[model samples]
Target: MNRFRPVRTMVAAGTVLAAAGTAHSAWNSTALRTPPPDPPPVTEYVSLLMPVRNEAGRVGPALRSLLAQEHLPRAEVIVLDDQSTDDTGDVVRRLCGPYRHARVVRGTAPKPGSPGKAHACHQLASLARGSVLVFVDADVVLASHAVASSVALLRSTGLDLVSPFPRQAAEGPANRLVQPLLQWSWLTALPLRRAEASPRPALSAANGQFLVVDATALYGCGGFAAVTDEVLEDMALIRALKRAGGQGGIVDGSRIARCRMYDGWRDLREGYGKSLWTAFGSGGGAAAVCALLVWAYVVPPLAALRGSRWGAAGYVAAVTGRTLTARRTGGRCWPDALAHPVSVGLLVALTARSWLGHRRSTLTWKGRPLRGWH
Candidate 1:
């Protein structure tokens, strides 16, 4: 037994490496799905609803793109200024003045238990007049055919809701390093086809940056009002839609829509830190996720650097997965794929910050203190 110790060690290492490689392959194969095909003929009226607060500078280009939509003839654009302290309301009015169907709504203060953005979205949904509602973030710039393509996908697929995640336009170092992981996270973790078919909310994922939903289906799920206090309203809404027996899925909309979600490192940090705690369901879930991330992303690289051949293979597979996702989503590949360990480290830090803030009741966004998790 003493003489066979080396053999046992080798076997253990081999088993770990094999498991890692299998997991990597599973993730890589599912990383970048074929994007949905182009739009078929759809003449339905589409309403573009955006909720904004202190986004005076960013909202203009998004509005311009919405107004310039070519395929949808009877489209209307609605912008809800969620009690902005800046020139957001004025800017929206001035920019929308030229389009007859475009209008801006002044949002009232959120109720006692409601989250700000969710409340604003609810108001916009209440006022929407189209059968199809396309919720666009203030910073998202849509291609001329984006609305038509998205609506066509929803109609063609028979899904009640669809989040056409846009291509993230990362600027600063922090943005470039971290934002790509957004696309990669769901792309690798959740199998899109299975999520589309399953009604389990746990499997549901969505990006609120550019989401499309059937107005009636949204109403059937209690609308944004149902998720009024949810910090991750996108995920909450998707789960609600799924629980209501409605089907929806995410599609690669990198070619059709683009967004610069954060201006710099600080912006990116706070933006993510606000909701990271609740993102994983509970504290235990968050811990499990952290452990998995560290094991999957960090351990292999460290082991490789320490002279483990199996770790080297795992590292290669991990980088390959990141490269695949980046190429498909237009995210940076070179340094990011190589920097996976660093990215995981930063994410772990962010998660810790988020959890600490949640415990201390100090997590806030855009000047409002975040309410405790449900």
Candidate 2:
């Protein structure tokens, strides 16, 4: 056998695995079905909870969208103002004045060991009177039937929690390169149906931007307090819920909601730097994941430029998988998918910056220092 044959075989196998995963995700992925014209009456009460900090400029659309929700007669909207330096509280109060079902609560400083967002969520949970809770980010704008459709899916699937991932709205070049990776990461790497059926924490996936959870299971699993110090609290919360014998997973929510998470490259870098270090559990795991990404994505494209057949095949498979994921998740395909290797490189760079910040105790989000860095 040629000395480099094994290396080529490994590259080919990795590409094939990625292709298989993309195909499986596409085949089994579930979308939040549009509500029927006369949707069955919802009997369970729902609490639409929002946590905001320095979101004054953008919270209006999100609050408006929540207030305009249809088929949720027995629901209440609650916004927690997490001590924003901006007029977020005033903005929410003004918007809520016209809707009796909506109200704003001022949040206190988070106790030691608790992140601000988690503290706000915990406080909101305490005040909720509903059997179901839908946690939405201030940046996300929901469709009129988002809540109704999500609840229907939850009931139909018998899941304790479900994340309806919004269609990421990417603006500039930086966003075009990175935003698609949000859904593509899980879509290509995870088996969604299997994740829902399995209780293993490692098999779980979620997006907190528009998460719906059965309140009973949430409390039973310790709620946000269980993940108080977690940087990636959404994933941690799902893992905790699963560990408590509850089931949950992600679904396509592109048609029902959308969010633009970052403004540009600088904003995106800061947004990711604070939490990416904890994404893979530890420093070693982060390194391993980055290495695998480079090997499976970046290397093949480079070798393809040098006329290697296996390399060309691997690069094609990577692009094909990206295109499929984008099409499935309502992201920009075509030229964006062609830059898959560049996306992986940026992700690796962000991961490194995240680790550096973690080690130097420099991570922060929205003006609050991240605790539990040791």
Estimate, for each residue in 207-307, the C-alpha lDDT of model 2 and write its tens digit.
98999999999999999988877878899999999999999889888888999999999989999998899899889999999998888888878878888
Q: Stretches of candidate 1 above 4 Å error?
A: 1-41, 112-114
* Stretch of 10 with least lDDT, candidate 2: 30-39
Error of 1 at 39 (Å): 3.1
For each predicted model, how many residue pairs clash, with residues at least 3 apart or on different chains?
0, 0
Candidate 2 displacement at residue 323 in angstroms:
0.9
C-alpha lDDT score of every prediction, in listed order:
0.82, 0.86
Model 1 earns a TM-score of 0.92
Superposed by TM-score, candidate 1 places the C-alpha of residue 109 at a distance from the truth, in angstroms, of 1.1
Q: Which one wins on TM-score?
A: 2
